[model samples]
Target: MTSGPECPLLFLDVDGPLIPFGSSSGHPQDSASDTWTSADQGNPLLTRLDPELGPRLIALGCQLVWATTWMEEANEVVSPRIGLPRLPVVEWPASSTAEGPRGLHWKTRAIVEWADDRPFIWVDDEISAIDRLWVDASHPGPSLLHRVDPGKGITDADFSAFDDWLRLVIPR
Candidate 1:
């Protein structure tokens, strides 16, 4: 809830980071076809979300913001399921595809703009080397562009990386 400049921003993407699309062993994507019902509102993918993630993310002590195509819908559909309260959603640019360089992810520029020179972390599966280069050149503050495996989702390793980076950017 704290979005002050002193707090580092954590721009979270819902798909690959929260819902693993890889193997059928650990993720819900395996039984999606058989288990989906009207109660799911047709989004079987929602079942892949880990309810335990909210507390883990909050413990990182950063301002969490939705940075997915789900937009504000992330607050309604994804939040409660993961125990997160309503969070600030990143508003993507209207011509996202048209603005960035070739191979650059569309969300890259807007995410940098949103951070506004404050330290930030962008977690998404779609991030590319081009996006990292762009952020390094354009963003003035510290940043970590962590790409998650869509097949595996966010792992404990990812949290460890976050902790490592936060230790450097945030004072204890």
Candidate 2:
């Protein structure tokens, strides 16, 4: 919420970006309770996150907003699953979808108003061109939308791309 005005923002996510696409399950309280993520490889979601990426990236000085379908489940489910601290979550809008909307991931509209004016990175699996255009046109400097490929875990290749973005594009 506070990420809009002057500070840089990182709208983080869980199910798709952090835990790998389709790698997470429903809330523990939900009737469709399932444990996401394969026990084999853990999760390659945050190769260069706050604690792991070290302070250099943290010195980028950005606020991380958990912009995912995880919603409240971010606390009940994702926190323990990924070993991340209790990060703030952005609630998806109350819209409708035909096939795969309500059950697991909800389409997020709140991100528009919540993004504010800060530089932001939207890391999600469901991001579309329309979403990218919306944020690119409206938000502040260094705003970007990164699509993490499903099934394939976040590899070094992905971080390499991010590094380019930070260095060449943003260059902060």
Candidate 3:
């Protein structure tokens, strides 16, 4: 098994996916005015991640990266709190629509620029088939992109889904 957070890199989006985008009562702010509507705005989130999950992803030879609108926000704030290994920083692109605050094109572009021979999993709520197609076509090595609903939170169901994919892709 891999001993470092350098292979099977897992590109994580700090806002919507890792720290489910919501509040204390899980009040989902799906309104047009809720751009910064993540609990990450409230308190530290990753401190709450199940200890088992981090180790498991690492055991699978996965690395965690902050791939959100936060950009280097993780490097400044999230990483030290979560104790996640500091990986490369990714910035959002300049072509994102500024109407409602979602800038997925930027994320996609980041993925494209950051592509390498290492296998990766892009876990974000806004990714689509176009995203999957974009990376699969443009990047090197086998790729998996999972669109996790922030409303559901990263429950056991989430990990189970990831586990299924990992089992199929990772060699014994």
Q: Could you estimate the TM-score for every candidate?
A: 0.89, 0.61, 0.69
Instruction: Report the C-alpha lDDT of model 2 over 1-172, residue by residue, as the tens digit.
Output: 2334555566666655555544333212222225443432343443322223223323445566677665766655555444455667886656645233334334434665576554666667777776666566655566667777765434457566655655654445
- Write down the lDDT of every candidate, Cα atoms only: 0.86, 0.54, 0.62
The most accurate candidate by lDDT is 1
- Model 1 residue 96 lDDT score: 62
Write down the TM-score for model 1: 0.89
* Candidate 2 positional error at 106, Å: 7.2
RMSD of each: 3.3, 8.7, 7.6
How many clashing pairs in candidate 2? 3
Off by over 4 Å in 2: 1-7, 21-61, 96-108, 168-172
